[model samples]
Target: MEVTQANILETLPQDMIVEILSRVGQNSSDQLLILKSVCKSFLKLSEDPLVLKRLSLDRWRLSPWGNPKLIYLFNLCTVFGNPNAIFCLGLIGYFDTKYTDLGLDFLKRASNSQLKEAVYVYGVIIFASHQIEAKHVGLQILNETFPPVPELVVAVRIKVFDLMRQLWLFNRHPFDDVAMPCPISDHDGYFPQFHGFEIAIPECMSCFWAYELDVFANRFAYN
Candidate 1:
């Protein structure tokens, strides 16, 4: 195409551009990266975390595209090292309704020796970030799948304790609300039944909270 033709194509509607990019993204090829770097609009779409995240994982049962999407996701987890990688791993189930069981499976698989520590820290972060939300989706996978993951859970709790101490000395009072970095700042703000203790990941769950735990069970077991 001539330079003028190329310039005209570049003026396509933003919506059309995004639509084309998403369609091309479905191809599972690195060529998408090249196109992204060629223009501002394409770069923005490509950088969307969800886009890269989905590209990094297997397409929901959309078999044989690249023939190694699972390995690709695992390799990505190893390379860039994002805790959310596991979450994205779990997100695949959302694409194909039939695979929702992978939610629980994702967490359970995370208990693999390699994934345990990440699970623990992330679990506490998720749980304590906000008890209401935390209680709904904490490390139920680690607890339910391993059922006896007290040591791992407790370790994460202790790490948070240490982190809190660090915050007190630096951020000065350390009681800032956050996923992590709140010092001595603990609250089961949502689940009082844990002995009136707001244990995030939990060394153990009391009988009273069993029903509350069901939230993750169904979501984990299904979505």
Candidate 2:
């Protein structure tokens, strides 16, 4: 007997099937959509809450001005509590004046879910505020996100940077105002500077990381 994919699926338990479907398409929505079209069972399994929550909508350019169908699909994932979806929705909400509060709520939920990108973005937004107490809380959140150990900090920063870059490209928007640098200076007296497209190193690691976040925020702000 020639064993087919459907045959394999039928032989496996439902939980195991869900795990397999969740892993398919490298978490890409496009690949998952293809899988869904293969048959009715695959289509039904694709919408399983577990599968939806695990789906990554990164490949889809999520924007109010973008593809409506894709946006709807992304929203469906968000309804299923997909962290990436929640994070993206938070960004969209944060940028729009009407949905700012709701956006922050989404971001907070994503951050609590241990989504590193959400934590970094949410922390930066709070840190960038004018309120001193908020800044302290933001700094604390950032500290927890990046960790104190040098090696771990480097690894987390690298991952966060890549995630930010992808997100920046995924949702590009234009703003009239340019992003201004934070007024806070380094405690070590090293002048904060920008080295063209790269983040300049400063004496204080905190200052350096904060500067990087400011730059990331600026990129999103300007375009």
Per-residue CA lDDT of candidate 1, range 1-223, in tens?
Answer: 5676446657988667766765565465366767877777677766444454334322233222355855564445434433335543433432223454564355435444234444553343345434555544654533543444344454644543332332212211112333232222353323322434443453335321332223222222221
Q: What is the Å distance of residue 189 in model 2 from its true position?
A: 5.9
Clashing residue pairs, backbone N/CA/C < 3 A, model 2: none
RMSD of 2: 5.7
Q: Give all candidates' CA lDDT scores.
A: 0.43, 0.66
Candidate 2: lDDT over CA atoms?
A: 0.66
Best by lDDT: 2
What is the C-alpha lDDT profile of model 2 across 1-223, one tens digit per residue? 9988777767667787678788873367778888787666777787788888888766655453476767666777888898888987787676644667898899998888778778877877777665668767877787777654434444555654554543433333322231424336525433445467444455454565556555555566433
Candidate 1 least-lDDT 10 residues:
166-175
Off by over 4 Å in 1: 1-6, 48-223
- Top candidate by TM-score: 2
RMSD in angstroms between candidate 1 and the native structure over all alpha carbons: 16.8
TM-score of 1: 0.27
